[model samples]
Target: MTRLWIPFITLLSSALFTNAAQASADPLVTIQKKWAQCQYQRSQEKQQIYCFEQLIKRNQQALNSAPTRADLKVWLAINKSSLAGAQGGIGALSLVEEAKDLLEQVIDQAPETLDGSAYTSLGSLYYKVPGWPVGFGDDDKAEHMLKKALAINPNGIDPNYFYGDFLAEDGRKKEAIQYLTRAQKAPPRAERPLADQGRQQEIAAKLKELQ
Candidate 1:
């Protein structure tokens, strides 16, 4: 298994959080900022673990308040998956399992929510988790879900990056480069500087390695 590595902030809309400067009061926006900080800024394993744990609590509270919100469900799923990656072990399996369930619900209820983020995140999970009895990793399913996300948001940075990364990991470097280049040139998210910077660094590193 590759571990559940995926972006916390995928292709999202401004309507989800409103204007960046005025979104400080929005719970989802707060969750997004904290997730970016934890995933990108924090380096220490213990600190990262702590950050994700806190994020999970906050996300859960928000979800409880807005049970019908698919976006909240997606954030909760992301928090759990990120925590699973940080807390690697057999124990992490449960976290990802729950995360998978939550994502499945979002996909069922609103596959296009957050601009197809559920598909992107779910696809990442499928490839990253262990396969067979241990977990549900499946390259075929990963590719399918990733392609679905790409279809919904073809030019989005996260979708292109994820699909490209999937190709690269599968030994299709030439195809990976094409999608990665598009991701590199994808327009920036005005509200997520930290996430954009961090993901760009990751894309650059992957491209460098492939080249």
Candidate 2:
């Protein structure tokens, strides 16, 4: 299973917190900053696994301190998801299972704190993992999770774009075109260029295929 990891930025929107400079620092914010740093490290392709593990450690500490903060829980889950990808790269199935358990906990707690972000993550997990007789990917589970995400936030770019990718990979050409088109038309984000361009290309290609 080749995991498609979503960037942490989408899961932790600036608007979700008050102005960072003006707001007093909390354990949640501190952990979030660490997680953001880890994401930056991953992007730079430097010590990806170690950086993510550091993020997990920080988030775990924060969660222990303030276990009720839904945001921290979700962020922890997101970090675990990234860690699973890192583990997969190294052929570590055991680590992937550990990460999956963390994600499930996040979903069980609050699926709405991150604007249906958890569902998008889980959907990608199911979509990317290789299925039974071979591995763990389950398209049915992927579709269910993606649909739940869409229901929670119909106009969300991440779900639309990723779900489009899932549909395309599953040979549902028309549905894929629809979702990719929706993603391309999504509200602009200053920090999500890759997601924006990827959806645009997906839409264009699927549109061509249908025609």
Candidate 3:
């Protein structure tokens, strides 16, 4: 799916880099942090689009350097998805399709990468996009992927939040509230204060609507 349904997501590495050198040393971590900034901190539509495009390019270069790196591929897909969300239109579908392919690659190579982030992201896409004839949206596949993510990271904020959101969207408010509540109580990420805060606000908003 695009950004509007479920915004671009990146899981923060547990280790927090203290300096620019440390940040640059890990291209994946750097891109993830930048993604949070672009997704949550930026407000201007044009700027957000530019930011996502730049990240996508940078991520693609990283992937080129390390073709076998599933993590890099995952981030590249996320940036592409974000860009698709920002520049919505008939054209956006192509970007998301590209993202879907990248994510699928990650799953095939490393389903356990980033605590099953590929599953969470892929599941979100399945539900957010339109159904066949128009898009490839499928509720059953979405549930399957989301559940796989949940099984991998039971207490993860992203998985729970996303599963809850999926359930809510499907008109299952009671179950959605339960997962959302667990997501709200998930531990904070020392490396991602901004993302944690932004996500919490989103969870709160979702709960408010469901309740």
Give each model a TM-score: 0.92, 0.72, 0.91
Q: Which residue pairs overlap in candidate 3's backbone? A: 1-125
lDDT for position 43 in model 2: 56
What is the per-residue lDDT of model 1 for residues 1-211, given as tens digits with 9 covering 90 to 100? 3544443334454335446566876788888888899998888989999999999999999999989989989889988988888888778889889988999999998999888998998888888887888888899999999999999999989889989988998889899999999999999988778888888998899999999
Instruction: Output the worst ten-in-a-row residue range by lDDT, candidate 1.
Output: 6-15
lDDT of model number 1: 0.85
Residue 42 of model 3: what lDDT? 81
Candidate 1 Cα errors over 4 Å, as ranges: 1-22
- What C-alpha lDDT values do all the predictions have? 0.85, 0.66, 0.83
lDDT of 2 by residue, 74-174 (tens): 66766776666655543544454554566677778777766777787777777776566545668889899889888887887778877887887787878
Clashes of each: 0, 3, 1
The order by descending TM-score is: 1, 3, 2
lDDT of 3 by residue, 1-211 (tens): 2324445564433334588788679888778788998999789989999988888888889889999888788778878888877887667889889989998998998998888889988988888777788778889999999999999999999999989988998889899999999999999987778889888999999999988
Which residue pairs does candidate 2 place in steric collision? Answer: 129-137, 130-136, 130-137
* Candidate 2 accuracy as TM-score: 0.72
